[model samples]
Target: MADFDIELDASGLNCPLPVLKARKELNGMKTGQKLRLIATDTGADKDIAAFAKMTSNPLLDFYIDGEKRYFLIEKGAN
Candidate 1:
């Protein structure tokens, strides 16, 4: 399986932008690849979760570090 290689920094972006950027980043990855998303938007916690569910992608992990929120998502089958 391919490992996570993409890093999307959405720290300054808001709700939709964070999710939208993540979606766009995921689109450029192959199946089994992973994406690392960094965002400061508080809403992204919920938005990213819902985005993963809606797209059927797997959210490998999520956590908050100080002021930053990080998400690791694995690309799903297309």
Candidate 2:
């Protein structure tokens, strides 16, 4: 897995918030950079997956770390 250049905590958020925040954060990041996102939403897995595909972001890794869901996403080429 790639090392993260940024870390975001989206825990306790629900629905689209986590994905939305991740999108917002990625907007300021350099392309190809990795972001480590920690979220607690049960729906985040599917939402983030779909969002990554839809937005052209590469989901480098995804796994559950204890009670939280971890996502390693690489910024897309613009």
TM per candidate = 0.93, 0.94
- Please list the Cα RMSD from the true structure of every candidate, rounded to 1 decimal place: 2.4, 0.9
lDDT of 2 at 54: 93
Q: Please provide, for model 2 over 1-78, each residue's C-alpha lDDT reduced to its tens digit, 9 standing for 90 to 100.
A: 458999999999998899889999999999999999999998999899999899899898999978899999999997
- Against the true structure, candidate 2 reaches a TM-score of 0.94
**Local distance difference test, per candidate?**
0.89, 0.92
lDDT of 1 by residue, 1-78 (tens): 235678889998987999999989888889988898999999999999999999988998999998799999999998
- What is candidate 1's CA lDDT for residue 2? 30
The TM-score that candidate 1 achieves is 0.93
The runs of at least 3 residues in candidate 2 whose Cα sits more than 4 Å from the true structure, single-residue gaps closed, are: none
Clashing pairs in 1: none
- Winning model by lDDT: 2
Local lDDT at 35 for model 1: 94
